[model samples]
Target: MTPPFHSRISGLAARTLQRLRSAVSGRLIDPRNYQPPLPLPGGLSRAQIHDALTAVSIDGSASGELFGYASSDLDRFLYTLAMVPEGAVGKALEIGANPYFNTLLLRQFRPELELTLVNYFGPGSAQGKQTVSFPGFKGVADAVTFQYDNVNIESAALPYPDDSFDYVVFCEVLEHMTHDPLRSMLELKRVLKQGGTMILTTPNAARLENISAFLEGRNMYDPFSAYGPYGRHNREYTRHELHMLMTHCGFEVEASFTGNVHPDIPLGQADASTLNRLIGQVRHREHDLGQYLFTRWANARVASEKLPNWLYRSYPAERMAEGQ
Candidate 1:
């Protein structure tokens, strides 16, 4: 399926911003900064790494219905997931694992992993709307279990007992839980074992494409969908915003960085040294930048004191009832 008008416009907007930066400045640029994350050490070349990351391809599929890590905000996340410190994973819980591309990737890269995939939907369920054509993951892990729970993340009690998982992968699910992100984080924290790892990825509200959207009195979201705002992205975050959310929920962030540029996004030319330098710096850490921000946090051995009143004070029960 073809991508919608908004996605194409957003991609073009992102490209134009980068190109403008490149053209307005004069200096030699390092080409490496514009490339994607470095390939993993598993003997796969860059092209192979990308293909493997996107284990399921939706190339000819229409845009909105397309699934998998290839073209969505999740592309950088799979790359970041591949880079999780080797040997750090044992038992893992994946929230929102409907598509399950990461599970497939980890099966190749970390065959010993045990995964529990928890989602509101999966392969055979009526809610299993995405990736219907891919069949299911094959020859992945020795153990992979699927569980279903459609309760809202903000207030629902996770079915698992406390401290049940060594790692929790919650990628690109946050923006969808706009009304109660803090509560969702707390839920994830409660299920994770002390010192367990939590790998998170979310869109950056300050991405260059968004900045352009704001200046033009437009937002890149699709407003007409059934989920409406939440169906697309109910909310997005900046690097600081995500860090604060994690800290408030008692997870100690270990490392953070940004990447996952749209393939159509432009990298400034080598001749536009000034713009290239700016782009390099922003891409390195922060600024008008990448499509998604990635972070890994360790569930602290000792939980912090309960979050401040302000954290939940704004979350009126009425708003929570609305459920985004």
Candidate 2:
């Protein structure tokens, strides 16, 4: 047997090695996810954190949440706004507006607009005793319109006039709650006025690495903790699954790509082009090694992040952010 001090040193070394393996995980892909956050008066409360974190942990750290994930996807969507034209959207409805989603950003992008957001509430914020509470009015007063309401049931219709809005948003909320999310998707189709914009952001279920991991039998959702596999989640979805559902619901995909992620890692003293390339490379390859990566990840995950974004199409994986 090893001496106590020697064993301690060995354990520490093993942990470090495992961390290196996990940290280097970005190399598994050349590319790319955030969750729907609840609106809290104090802002993103502990209970909200616990539930969202629990949902991600259901599949360990890998199966859910990817590097530069959410922010990148949203940014891509934002860049395309010029093509779709904001005038096409008059009033909007955002489903699952608990905390995260850049409603503030939308306010910035389309200042002359009206928006409504919706979501499930727990017992504290809910009308039903067993349901998730409803956040206090002050919680979302700053971010949401004056017309927010808690309609708790999973399959219940929204509290709004028919054809009341010109746009609908189902950002980062599909896989968390609905068992038959297609129904909700259709409901969104119903609520959207003619020629309205329907913006959605969800994880691509069939990612390259994920498909590889599945075949190799190493999914990240392997929950070894007290809770079962995929802690609070009902399912995970791929891009193809999402596309089929969206089309089936009667909305056409105007444009789509990974949104709201800053694929670059932060390296010091680089030119703007180099900085952009390095951001993706750094984010993709070395994210788990630095606090900055977590910052970028949080920004990527949250609806309104402060991460600096670049045009990803110009620097395809071939030019920079190479897989190793």
Candidate 3:
């Protein structure tokens, strides 16, 4: 028999069945089923997409599903996992989980992980040990506390020995360490195990403003340095500068990404500049770089991966470290 003639229509029908199975764990569904959210942007700019989400936050303030997560925290969470490495995750840490999404990611992605959260201050039901001025945490989930050695990343003696965690998350946080970011990173590395991962998201100095500066032959680095913006972030990173920082600290830099869910008026989309100005007046690094091309590739199939969502999530890249 000639394999029963798998025609185009039949093949498509079979593939559709396969997809539905894969998406719904191989369950048959009626055509009237509620569709999951798609990542398609309807060709929106970065800010427009976030604005839409924010609008929902406004109208549905008491809503539980997406409302529980802060816009920034969810953005960070999406960015962090969207680019995770392939294979088993050994261990992970997020020095800053904010009040919303960061810890959610810790719980969601790697709940089995031994979790330790260090922030400038502690929030939520998470416990902490006052090692440094900053608050620390020990959140619940399948995750347990390795230790709440709450030393400031910028402080001397990071309160833990070297090569500690399998992964460390530094989201929109490093540049704020004006006192000694390098020392903080060194401490982060100290805790990160050899061949560990760092999922980093920060303001990109190489944004449209700096691109214009480059076209105008002006100094771009100083304009976006880690020195002073709202007197909060001591510096920001151009991709290369960040890579150097990680490499210098003995990190392989498993992945580096930019997610500006909090961005200035995205290019050509609804200006939102009024909202943009207000955000700028308060938030320091909101407009650095809203979207980025990925640098690394992860191993397993992402559960809920979508294009805009992936763009908004963490990406792995150039994990091949120099010495290691």
lDDT for each of the candidates? 0.58, 0.41, 0.44
Query: Can you write out model 1's per-residue Cα lDDT over 1-324, one digit (the tens) per residue?
Result: 111211222344555555565556542232223334443445655455444434453333543433333545344644555545665558887777755566556655666667776665212442222332233233231323334454455656777899899888888789887566776887888889998889888877766555445544665673655745446777778877887677766788776655544542333322345444554565433232566776788888544434444344564454332212
Considering lDDT, which of the candidate structures 1 and 3 is the better prediction for this target?
1
| Poorly placed runs, candidate 1 (over 4 Å) | 1-36, 49-64, 67-74, 121-151, 227-230, 264-288, 301-324
Q: Clashes in model 1: which pairs?
A: 1-61, 1-62, 1-63, 2-62, 2-63, 26-273, 27-273
By summed lDDT, the worst window of 10 consecutive residues in model 3 runs over 1-10
At residue 278, candidate 2 shows an lDDT of: 39
Candidate 3 on 1-324: residue-level lDDT in tens? Answer: 111111211244554554345345522221111111122222434354333332232122333444434445445444554444433356666776533244443454455666666655422433453211111122221222333444456654655566677767667677566644655665666677665666676766655444434444655443343424422655666766666555555545344334444333223322233323433354323323333322331211111111122112242434222232
Worst window of 10 by summed lDDT in candidate 1: 1-10
Number of the top lDDT candidate? 1
TM per candidate: 0.68, 0.49, 0.50
Q: How accurate is candidate 3 locally (lDDT)?
A: 0.44
Ranking by TM-score: 1, 3, 2
